[model samples]
Target: MADASPKHDVFQAIADPTRRQLLKLLVDKEMAVTVISGHFPMSRTAVSKHLRILSDAGLVRERKVGRETRYSLQPEPLLELKRWLSYYERFWENKLNVLKHLVEIDSETGTDRTGPNRLKDDQTPD
Candidate 1:
């Protein structure tokens, strides 16, 4: 995986729910392609293609041991994704703060969130 940026095709690769599930499966343990394929309904070739994209993304480490190739998760790229998600979390926090002001909560939790009123307040009036 020479491409260092995770935004382009690699993000597209993980946008598919199936591909995301495959990554989760590899998280806990290294698995063989055959074993990984068995978890999904797709054909071996389709699974292989997904694996290739993941490898390109620097997400999976593919190793050849004699007759079979095994794959393990390389979590560094996922750290990038996590960092990206944290930014969204900050956005959510800001939105929550704005709502906090709108609602006039004196004892606020420092977020737009407050009790059951939150659900009704967030609704669009239209």
Candidate 2:
């Protein structure tokens, strides 16, 4: 059976490079699809598809003004992604701190944890 979950979650929506770029473009100001399509080499329809995915993910909002449709970034959904990544960031920070402590210990003991070094352990007396 196919997955019943949404195919266009914020994580999946931002996974595409094109969609990420589109978000970056929308960050500064709201813009019409025509203006956005001009920034990319692909046809407007292709850009629209990406926008649709972004919309599905709740990462983009649309407004109709006169005859034109304007798109803007909706950043609230990204807080979920940010919270998820922040956990990994703490994990990595702890790992890096442990690595730093190990390196400091190695440096103080004059021992190379990275195997034999030519100038130290591997040097031969001439």
Candidate 3:
């Protein structure tokens, strides 16, 4: 039986700026390779390679229309990236909460926020 799994993960596919731009282009509507290539400075073959990576990662869908192949965004795989990032969101929220508490304490105590710990005008750090 043929393997049904994606050859590349969403994270790997979107690691490149070119591939990310390709995803953005297809988000609104599908486009043929020739049309898509016009948006970037690279050759059509280069754009096609990026599309192939996105397709391998299951982040894009391609269809043949006569002699041309059209590509569209397949956002389902991005859910994995979303879930991974959501996990870190809580970590950042906790840090923000701690900073808020410290600021509240400083306000209550009338502590100089611009004290020795902070940099002064014309003071450059090493």
Candidate that would win on lDDT: 3
Model 3: residues with Cα > 4 Å off, grouped in runs: 102-112, 117-126
Better of 1 and 3 by lDDT: 3
What TM-score does model 2 achieve against the real structure? 0.74
lDDT of 3 by residue, 1-126 (tens): 999999988999999999999999999998999999999999999999999999999999999999999999999999999999999999789767766766777789887757777545444333
Itemize residue pairs with steric clashes in candidate 1.
Answer: 96-112
For candidate 1, write residues 1-126 as lDDT tens digits: 474564335567689888899899999999999999999999999999888888878888899988898999887777777878987898789778776665564455454445654556456322
lDDT of 2 by residue, 1-126 (tens): 986554589999999999999999999899999999999999999999999999989899999999998999999999999999997898689767766766677789887766754234333223
Rank list by TM-score = 3, 2, 1
Q: In candidate 1, how many clashes are counted? A: 1
Q: Which ten residues in a row have the lowest lDDT in candidate 2?
A: 117-126
Q: What is the TM-score of each predicted model, taking all chains together?
A: 0.69, 0.74, 0.81
Q: Deviation in angstroms for 101 in model 2?
A: 3.7
Arrange candidates by lDDT, descending.
Answer: 3, 2, 1
lDDT per prediction? Answer: 0.79, 0.88, 0.89
* Model 1 weakest 10-residue run by lDDT: 117-126
- Evaluate model 1: give its lDDT: 0.79
